[model samples]
Target: MQLSETGRGVLVSGASRGLGRAVARAFAANGDRVAVHYGTRADEARATLASLEGSGHVLVGGDLADPGDAARVVDEAAEALGEAGGGSGIDVLVNNAAVNLPHPLAETPYEEWAALWQRHVSVNLLATANLSHLVARRLIDRGAAGRIVNIGSRGAFRGEPDHPAYGATKAAVHALGQSLAVSLGPHGIGVASVAPGFFATERVASRLTGAEGDAIRAQSPFGRVADPAEIAAAVLWLASPAAEWASGTILDLNGASYLRS
Candidate 1:
């Protein structure tokens, strides 16, 4: 039940950008060796690794949307962590990679729908499951305790009409976390998902820029968008030992907007 992550290892998916990068850097600063998983942005991943707080954090690029690639990335993380001063398995697995294609359901093309659905399922669900399976195996093999943190969206409950697939996929992720928590609890592995609302991420900010971003911020109860670090703070807690008993729970980090409104 250590509060800090010293002498530990973590694997963070989608570390090339956004929330994943923030989570990875948080773990690195706290005392864990990190495996930076990037889907396409190798340079960004490498740069993130370079800027981390500790040595032994490594950048490993892979498109986790592919079934094979998902397992491969976890295996690589395990291997890298083993070589990085700890003779143990990775302590944390973060599933933070996702994509959303906004389209009205009525006008959405079948191909477009399928593509977006596939991306959401493959990357957000399949890949996360694959890595969790690998990490869970490694944890059992080493007889070490571990954690799984899935990055979900407020859409899980908010139910965005234009982002139906994204919302549905996240709702599915919530179900997956519950199942994983019950299934993996016997092996000392905890599973959970953290859903965020109205975070001012670069990708999101870019999309909802100008008046759109302002409106989004205003819609929230707090009347302001969340700082990325705020999201990272929640992740840091979930991965920390203090939260080991908490599993199968979807923590909603909204500013009471989603709940009260």
Candidate 2:
């Protein structure tokens, strides 16, 4: 009943659908065991686990907005993936869980704007920070090497007029990853982040239709948005041993839609 003892244990947060699910699949296909974490979508998370290419994948449920719940989620993942004499069990931590809701300045009330900002900060920035700390601390104690790949957004560099909170928090995530990369590199733990533009995810299916979709596709010269698999592939590579040297890097997956000097 113990999962594959040969592969590394991977924990991917917010993996109920879209990019998170794609990332989980990529890791599973690479022969690693994945812990799929979901906040409010147990059924979707289960489906994600079922659709994986291999066995030994587990589902973890938690509302990461709460610090206590976040800690518990990390502990559960480590315990589930731990081997008889294995280290912390989880060798890779993917901080992919986030909330992106719109609150346009002029159109929203002050109270509503404040509440949305708080929610965004809790779910997107703080959860990621806490999870990274938990995983990195364990890896350091065990004297093992690991990787942390944060799912950031191109909105961080560009702009999210309608979703300012999302953009700001994602920028914080990217900064956090870079700082961790510098500090964790000495411990053989590489940390990196990927900032992606609009992608084909269920959450954005509505925006990718008809005239709106056409405008979005036109953002990139390629005349199309990215497939979730494309971003997942980059995440997979970043977690690989070969990518250690590329630590502290924030690879852009926006397909030239937004460029920064």
How much lDDT does each candidate structure score?
0.81, 0.92
Candidate 1: C-alpha lDDT: 0.81
Per-model C-alpha RMSD: 2.1, 2.9
TM-score result, candidate 1: 0.93
Query: Which residue runs of candidate 2 sit more than 4 Å off their true CA positions?
Result: 1-6, 83-88
Q: What would the per-residue lDDT of candidate 2 be over residues 17-122, giving only the tens digit for each residue? A: 9999999999999989899999999999999999998777889999999999999998888888874356447899999999999999999999999999999999
* Clashes by residue pair, model 2: none
lDDT of 1 by residue, 1-261 (tens): 232457678889898877878888898888889999898888888888888997888777788888788777887888888834556657888888887778667989988888888787887778777888888887877777788999888888888899888888888888888899999888878898888887866687685778887788877777887777789889888877778877777898877768723
Q: Which stretches of candidate 1 lie over 4 Å from their true place?
A: 1-4, 83-86
Once model 1 is optimally superposed onto the true structure by TM-score, how far is the C-alpha of residue 157 displaced, in angstroms? 0.7
Question: Candidate 1, after superposition: displacement of residue 29 in Å?
Answer: 0.9
Model 1: pairs clashing at backbone N, Cα or C within 3 Å: none
